[model samples]
Target: MASVSTIYTMGTFLSRAEGLGQRVRVLVEGNWITGTPLSCDGHGVILDSGAEGQFLVRVEAISAASYALPEATVPRPRPHEGSGDRVRDDADDRAYEGTYATVASLS
Candidate 1:
């Protein structure tokens, strides 16, 4: 049997993502809770979901979680490379596609 490399869990992901300033999607029921990772430990994660919005998700309740893959293309788009409207729209689509990717929390 191949030895497992690392223990991959939402707690680990949330803790790491918080440091990287990354947004994350937590799967609850059949919906995805999209938010920025504020803090996390072995038990739960606190998510900042915009203006005065924050939610704590228990480690066990987070059936799944994900972050966007880093793009090597460029930080920001050129003059007319990509439109913000399109980017926002695509975010939803990407989530449904099972990748469950989200924009970085880096502002």
Candidate 2:
């Protein structure tokens, strides 16, 4: 029998991606989706999909996988920072106009 390669789960791949600061491309339901990996769990994977915004995808829906490395990329947000409702374009060094909510801890 031919040797079999170990199967890697989507969550496993995504977790590693978060550390490497890289984006991943996944094909789901005949659509090619590309984005920066944010977080992943047993149920789904979250991605920071550029202009399209973030996406939460179920692992079971993935059909294919690949890496999407952009020529230039934005720096990932700090751990303490909340979700980025507005993303800046590094190429132009300008911030796009958008509304973001401020989260306050009611301690």
lDDT of 2 by residue, 1-107 (tens): 89989889877777788789788887777666777888888688877867667778888887777787553533455444576555445544434232222212111
Please give, for residues 9-77, the per-residue lDDT of candidate 1 as tens digits. Answer: 778888888999998778865557677888887887888877537777777877788884543332343
- CA lDDT for candidate 2: 0.67
Pairs of colliding residues, candidate 2: none
**What range of 10 consecutive residues in model 2 has the weakest lDDT sum?**
98-107
Against the hidden true structure, what lDDT does model 1 obtain? 0.68
**Clashing residue pairs in candidate 1, if any?**
none
Measured by lDDT, the strongest candidate is: 1
Q: What is the overall TM-score of model 2 with all chains considered together?
A: 0.57
